[model samples]
Target: MSERINDIMNEEPKRGRSAFQPLIYAILVVLGVYIGSNFSGNSTFTHRPAASENPNKLVNIINKIDEMYVDSVEKKALIEKAINAMLEDLDPHSYYISSEELASVQEPLQGNFEGIGVEFMIQKDTLVVVSPIQGGPSETAGIRAGDRIVEVDGEHIAGIGLTNSKVMEVLKGEKGTKVDLKIQRRGTDDILDFNITRDRIPIYSVVASTMVEPGVGYIKLTRFAKNSYEEFMMGMAKLDEAGAESIIFDLRGNGGGYLHVAIPMVEEFLEDDKLIVYTEGVNSPRSEYRSQRRGRYADKDVVILINSGSASASEIMAGALQDHDRSITVGRRSFGKGLVQDEIPLPDESALRLTVARYYTPTGRSIQRPYGEEIDYDNDYNDRYDSGELYSEEKIELNDSLKFTTPKGRIVYGGGGITPDVFVPIDTIGASWYFSDLSYAGTIRRYGFDYSDSHRDELSSYSDVESFLKGFKVTNVMMEGLFKAGEEDGYERDERAIAESGEVMKIRLKAHMAKNLFGDEAYYRALLEDDNVYDAALEVARNYKDYAIVDGELTLLSATEVEEAMTTN
Candidate 1:
């Protein structure tokens, strides 16, 4: 009976052990799988890697070199170089700004920076005040154009090998800071002393605005800075008051600034809810900027001028207007830069302007040209000149795949710059090596400055731009003086070339003189009086029908055709 009981108990225990054996086997299999996935090179299991463990390869390499190097190395410089290299690999616009360069980088976008508020040039190793910024601390303190800053804060600065950067360092300071400047005026015998309270000085975006001709207004927008909209509005109002029926907006040589500033300015022309521009990228979602406010000049005829130097915010504004058929684009193709960069501040006060998204026109045209590792993207404008694209409309090669139709069925090309409706090929009719030498040698500028300085009293007597334009003329004596100056500067005088470019040189000299006397507004007014592009724009404003796009094609009336029409009319 005892043997039977022991046998039954042993069989029950063996049955329980058998049941647990399968569970133990299952646990071992899971442990093996986890171990293999975590350690094995050929593992297929998805185990999350730790954030800290997955260190940057570049950082790791840098650290290794820092710890085990032959000699001491500047870690900061190495890191900066690495950052720049990384950015360069990404895109052309993605760039790193060091701590030292951060302030100047933000100055234009900010519209204002605390400084003495005087435009200076290092002439003869002396800081010469080109002009005190309008309504600025220097201007308020009676600082005049052509005044030489001899001393700053009781320290003699003249003839001390002063550079522009050094001068800026000495003059620019925190707001409400006082700076005592000893000025050497051209006519004054005594060194004039003035105490200027350094304050927030504005950098104007609307460089110039005036009624170009009867019933036409011209506004030269150099950049889309912070106060651009305000400046633009004021300019437009001035034009409106002057009875301007049409507007010619110049964006030539404007290498763009803030996008927020541009969008608002674009909205000034576009109707409410109209798509201005859209941006998208792999990381960035499709975001659209539309006209939010009622446009100020919705019904006004506008002609936008652009060239290869026009980029970024300039392209955005131009593309929006073109896509919507709100304005007529005139000039050569624009600088293709449609990438949107976001300014990201690093911990070290350095900055990374990373290309976050690519922008498109309302017609879904990407204005950015194709870029590759081998391409010299910086010399693209030069390439255009070399390829004869700047001189002829036919040379502007457009891909059929890049074709996009505007709102009015007008076809526009993308994958490059914005093609103007009226393609004004670069006018190189009188451009000669001799004239170029004179211009590049600063002969004209020096002549203008000297002339202005000598006749400051007489030039300052002119109250308005119109008066200056009518009164000022580059005399034969002035031309002779300029040619002599050019000859002195190692530039051989080409009489034939000079004769060919004489009229242009005269106009430019007069413009420079005007710039010295009145301002940039007066300068542009004088310059554009004979500008072919400006004349073309005027013709467009007068008879827009002749240059209008019809059946997805533009009947761009040449200057001769427009002139003939004017004569007939």
Candidate 2:
């Protein structure tokens, strides 16, 4: 044993290992001490420390807290907070989910949850049902879109400051459980009652899909979930049936989800053997996801719409498409988050979403913005806003040293998020103070709901969206009612601001009414007509070849010296 230790310490360093001599010695010293302490006459070497001698530091601190001169502390809550604080130091994306929060946190990504389904909003301290989820318990139990939930099991709940979670607590339950609701429905003299049985309600990822024009299909994807692929494929099939020759894939405000779902969905839009993304880490090997089969959707012109909120799996799709010149991306730069996490469960039913690997795009773009222990994670968006990057493409700072070129020779900027092929600045037109007040007071939503309820039969009369969009106008009477609602909510009307905002407000009002009658597809159909980003996306979709990236569009950190810097760095 002594001879073996001497041999290891005196071992000559390899040709390229001169720099590691000290580190190698330190490691050997520790190994020598460990082996010397455990080596017995037996062939195998092992050491089992006594339970008392091998105490965990965290448990020791916790035990000390219990015994110290402090009041009774909820150990579980403290531990959870400590775990969160520790993970916060690691990175913004790595997080801790307590047992109580675990299920709710996992619900959306899991694709469904057991509950009485109704999309709702709070207004005047009352819970107003925006829409009963199609085919869900509330919808099946005769709950309509305009109904206001006033009571639960005969107990008054309205006018008592209802919160989203409070409503969820009373409504969501295990399968087969029942909850009674008293609704103040529009056009009804008396309160309507419903006894709804809770069941597994699907949380759809593909929120909206429709033919935006004669040959263009628009699909709004909210997130990449377990069932997202199937939902997306169904949307694709809907577009195919509608004879769609081009697609506008909207991923604005999508925070992202499962990569597994995103990879498969993006693959259907790319040619065979195209690499979508690859993840690598110190422990994790390089894992590449590639398209296996060519689908009909690959031939169609596709435009990806992404805003700052689009991230993770959303970037995977946009990056892949832009890298391969399969599609053109519009909207602002995406929310850069290339870190891949793997949830590790602890004994207390809580879990830690630990960052395990970093994913790169097809052209070796990391897509992750710089992060550090001293950096304030919450100020990221504000910093971008303050820098004027959100409003101007020229304000964006591109690091040329981290740059790579795509297969089609388009300049690909790495390290940050996926920069759009064409930038669409944030729209501020018709954004008057009166509109802001109305939005804050929820006047538009309330008035739209009331109007839709009263005119339900007439609104439903239109069999197609084009007719409804063309015929349904925001009358003076409707505007008057909305103003009245705003005044009642303590937001007095400003004539000048109102004049400036009326057109935009009317468009939003039309969207809200469309949502109440015909769901998300109709809502987007009405809303996108007035959206600046959507307009840009539509043009890109119609003529992707013309709008495609060119060498002149690429920005660099130092244009004159990028070549020298790339080779040196």
Candidate 3:
């Protein structure tokens, strides 16, 4: 048997070994191989063929270690490690997912999860309800926003070092299962107890949508999940009913999901058969995704909002619109994540989410940035800040080699993410260490919940978001209470600092309160009414034709007619 095993393992060492070789050698040393002593005349040495005609050198080494080493080892674990190491040699986006993590990984993108739906946050060592999902099990069971959950299943969960994962473990379970909760309401004397039946709660991709102005609509898509297109269309339908002539499509912080979903959403803005995006790679041939169906929103003026957090499908949609001169993109340059990952399921129920292709815009520009160390790629946003790219358009450089002309003869550059036509610098005014410390300690969120709880009856009186937005104002008493909470949380009470951050804090707190009472729509309506990015986009929409694509950038046309001059020439 040993001799037969030796025959299976005898492969010559290849030139230039990979980075994983040393680790494989270490694993071999740690887990020595053991051969059975019961090798008799009846015992047959089964010689199985390698996975491929050209057997993997790494696999051969691992097999040799398993068969010839002196002690017992988990060959499965070693194989998983080897697979992970091999993928690291490829692009940063290419990664290995374990069987244990596969379900959790798919849950968000699938747009539904089994749980008693109540969005929560750990505030002051307690599980505070940010908001109950409308019509969800929690909300149906009388779980109001700002209610503090003290116990789960009669177990004392709060003030016992509870974490987000621990809370999820206690709350989330099989559908139709019961989970009891003991709540602490601000005004209630006794702890409120309720039993919530777990059910399939929808995870919405479009968090907020409303009419920002009479003729303009504001729709914020949180991600490009499976049902994102449906949610977006529903929102648009409502906007259309409200007489919307223009749309402010907010894609800020929407780290993308399904490409299929995004393509259809992009189609809504484009004409029939227009090339929205195309993908190609060494392995993947050029496949162009075009607008196939006639869209209802074809003639509507569009403005897309993006930031450093917006990526993948977000970039695809934005780039396509910009290249076609269909919309004005506002905000900072987007997060450059143009790689298209294809999830290949392994035999062990795990998955290999490998970067199979690079997506390009209509003008053929790749939005993917150069990848180095994984940490560096993750910290690229901070690097942008350090390099002054986040605050100034001049700091953002375009690669001349990657220049491509749109159909309208406007130049656009590739080599990185989608650069917005109008750049809104990050607001740093009134940002102090005092404000930072308080925010870091979750003081702002906690204060909002506390204030909402106390003012629920008064706040609940407002029937419409517009009425609430115009009528409500943060009082001195509420400000003092927020400041007191900050002080209690070890954040010093600097009256001058608080005054400096007063306006932002007031608006943000009011937004949070609105979110607690109504939903994300009210929250955004309150917050974005004064947001700089939204303001910029609104400005562009107000004077839509005054601005035109010139050279490679967005420029305002002079009062002296250039198009008339060109016609004469």
RMSD of each candidate relative to the true structure: 17.3, 11.7, 8.3
| Per-candidate TM-score against the hidden true structure | 0.86, 0.84, 0.85
Q: Which portions of model 1 miss their true places by more than 4 Å?
A: 1-60, 487-490, 545-548, 556-569
lDDT of the structure predicted as candidate 1: 0.79
Candidate 3 steric clashes: 6
Count of clashing residue pairs in every prediction:
0, 0, 6
Q: Write the per-residue lDDT of candidate 3 for residues 1-569, one digit (tens) a residue.
A: 11000000011111234654665545432221211112222222122344653324434555777788677657666655655555666766676678987778777778888999999989768998888997799989989888899988878988888898898899999999998899988778999989999999899988887887788888999887778889999999999999888899999888777788888899998889999989898998998999998778989999999998888888888999989888888999988888887776655577667777888899889988888655566678789999999889999978989988877777778988888888899988767788788777778877887788777888888888888899999988888888899889888789888878888888878887887777888888888755889899888777766676666667867666557645667
Local accuracy of candidate 2 as per-residue lDDT tens digits, 375-406:
66557789889999999999988998988888
Candidates' lDDT values, in order?
0.79, 0.77, 0.79
Clashing pairs in 2: none
Error in Å for residue 561 of model 1: 15
Off by over 4 Å in 3: 1-21, 24-60, 63-81, 182-193, 373-375, 558-569
Candidate topping TM-score? 1
Report the CA-based lDDT of candidate 3 relative to the real structure: 0.79
Model 1, span 360-407: residue lDDT tens: 999999899878778887778789999999989999999999899887
